[model samples]
Target: MKWRKEEQTPPPMEESAVPDTGWATTSMSTGAMANWTAVVRWSAWGLLLAGPLLGGWALASARTPVTVPTRAEAPRAQPASSDAVAPAGFAELYVAAYVKAGDSDADTEELSAYYPAARSMSWSGEGGAERAESASAVQVRQVSAGYWSVTVAARITSSSKNADSGRVRYFQVPVRAAGGRGASGWTAAALPAEVASPTSSKGVAPELSYGSAHAPLDSDPAVQTVRGFLAAYLTGGGELDRYLSPGTTLHAVRPAPYTAVSVTQIAEHGQGPAEGAEAQVPPDGVQRRLLVDVEGDGKHTGSRPMSYAIELRARDGRWEVAALEAAPALAAPGTKSNSEEGQGS
Candidate 1:
């Protein structure tokens, strides 16, 4: 009574036909294959056309000039002390070399070294060949940055037998600092001229009386203040504004560079000549003159003795310097004490 045997089912076929419409029997005959072939042909033609363009571009790039950045050249350097102002003591040196009464050929030659060749020749030819007995008292003043005025006192004796004894004369000369081909540093800028020429007196000179001995005024408060001020001023030590008057020309009295000066002695002088006359008493509150001796040690100028005539007055309960001058003792006819000569010497 079992059911009848189940019927058997057959498997699907292994090979099947693909439908086509007006194409070859191969897979490459499809629309996709045609697009691929068209693209390949276009690529080959593009390669051929682009090759020359790329090569021309490379050649043009190589032929073009390249601009490499460069650095600018550095500027030249200058001297450290190139300021236009002349150095210290140059005016004095110029005066000493340029102004004199009479000079020999050798002396002129030596002096000529301080001037330009052309100027030296002119100076040598102009009365500088005569030799003189003595020349002294040279004074120099700076007129400007590179210019100076010099005054020299000298005595010249004539070569003739009948000629009178020489008289003291003052000659004024102008000088300039030169930086030329033949001359450098200080040089004589011009020839000298007679400013004051006074003859010697024929009569006998009058005798002078010696004054009473005076003692140092260091005990006085005013003198003490002045001593301290001078010490500071000459040594470049403490500030001097407190002791100096407003608008005071302290710079003029300031010592030379790299110089240290110490006050050695201070003596009070009466208000008149120290000899041949009674001492006149100065009025109360009037400034008094003091003779001060100082010793100095300098860089260029070695240690030496110096004397100064200092005047001071009392103001605001403090003493202040009013004026200063150099003092040297020289007793002779037609000769007077000159501060410039004292300092320059």
Candidate 2:
């Protein structure tokens, strides 16, 4: 049997229309490009103008240097329990009053100020008659916290046949300090005890820097300057300004104590202006230090010997007094010095 064939047909798609946008998009892109170019150009101009201004500002600020302040260091704090200072003065006063105490009511009252319980003098009431001329604390040592031992040197005069010839005696006083850090009261722990003099090694004199063996002669300009300056300083015989260095201030002895002053010996520090160079003045700004020995004669007091440590500066080819040294300069230990011969020369 023959079957009938069925025909299969495909369905058609629906159609929709789209508008063209190429022209509008191209126009918008061109406008954005122009705006970007304008922004780049403005930024380049701003950089070019601002670079010189910033450079000028940096250079102007760097012209003057700034000085930084230094920070000060704080001092170290001391412990509260330690006795930072010794009671030397207090011990001297107490010992002075004790040595002069006698058998009188006034003595008891004065002694009570230091030792409240002191009813009588330490010695027996019989023939104890010694007085102190002067008392000074020479040495102080701390034995422990709030305790010290002070050695006082006193010039004592005795009533029995030795008033004119007073002797210096050493007395050790035990002192006690109370409160914190030595800021409070001081008291004597006990009565003073007579002690031997402090022991020291002999032949231990300090070596000074004046070590030149060749003494300056009278023709030396520096020696002449010193002689003239000393004459004015001790005797007021000449004007001080004529011999003083610039910026040096020295006053003559008031009332002109001496009639004449003569420089006896001069010892120079270091090798002075060569051997023959001593006749000619040293160059400007050259300095010389001399240890000079002199004698001063007064109208009534007679001749008195004195020594001076002086410094001289050269100006305008002449020497001028610079300074009267407070003390002679010290040399290294074990170094040989001619300072002993300074007095003898």
Candidate 3:
């Protein structure tokens, strides 16, 4: 019987007044837009004009040589440690003062003549190559189990300074021992006036074999010359003088003379760095790699003809054989035949 009426409330309206936070507001007019456009265009033009100039300046700066400080006094070179380990390939040792042109470094002929029968001449591997010479006084004493202490009286001929000056380097190697061993420990050697029984023929002469020469090595002119020597050496013999680097090494093969009658399988060669930026067998420039299989009939005995390593190099606008590490005998053709030998000819 007692029904009550309820009153409804209306929703509030959104206020249009400003917020309590404080900030600045701005607007762009037509003139302002034009000004901004002008600024952008001017900036683009400026960048375009400065681009080439800045590039040129950068290039010039790069080309400019940098200043390096020079030492006031002469620079001294550090000598190798005597106690250092000998090179792995060190095969023999010889105490000599000079390495003459015709002298045999492989056999120590010059050394033998100089220091004849003073004491026993015992040698093993781990001694670097030795060149026989005519120095004033030279003695070789074993410093370590595998090392030798060579002392010289500071001779004028064999010194590094004389050799660098391109002079006729004569030298005398002084003998030294690790202990306070006096001259008694040093063996005396005699010097001969002339080299005896020199080999005129290439068939028996020592050959200089080379691997491949890469940068900083094959680029050297001396390395090129040595390669040339190998080329002449391969074909029995040619102009040895045309080749033959100043420090060219001489190799000796046992069982008497090592002869190279003919070299074959040159086409089987690969590429190496000894060549000067060119293909193998190029008329001029260097060759990088050479895999040579030599074939020759000599005093060597085997089931087939003897072969030797005829490593080659192409540098200084020429192809040259660089190595002959002794060739093995060629086996009979067996089941295979020489049918591949003949071509269009």
TM-score winner: 2
Q: TM-score of predicted model 2?
A: 0.65
Candidate 1 clashes between residue pairs 3 or more apart in a chain or in different chains = none
lDDT of 1 by residue, 204-323 (tens): 544211122244344455556665676667777666666665556665345544357766665455323333322233333556566677777878788678767777765665567776
User: What would the TM-scores of all predictions be?
Assistant: 0.33, 0.65, 0.22
lDDT of all the models against the reference? 0.56, 0.77, 0.40
Off by over 4 Å in 1: 1-218, 252-259, 271-284, 299-302, 326-345
Among the numbered candidates, top lDDT falls to 2
lDDT of 1 at 74: 80
- Give the Cα-based TM-score of candidate 1 against the true structure: 0.33
List the candidate numbers ranked by lDDT, top first. 2, 1, 3
**Pairwise TM-score winner, candidates 1 and 2:** 2
Model 2, which residues run further than 4 Å from truth? 1-86, 117-123, 126-128, 142-147, 162-165, 178-185, 199-204, 212-216, 338-345
Error of model 2, residue 260, in angstroms: 1.6
Model 2: how far is 327 from its true place, Å? 1.3
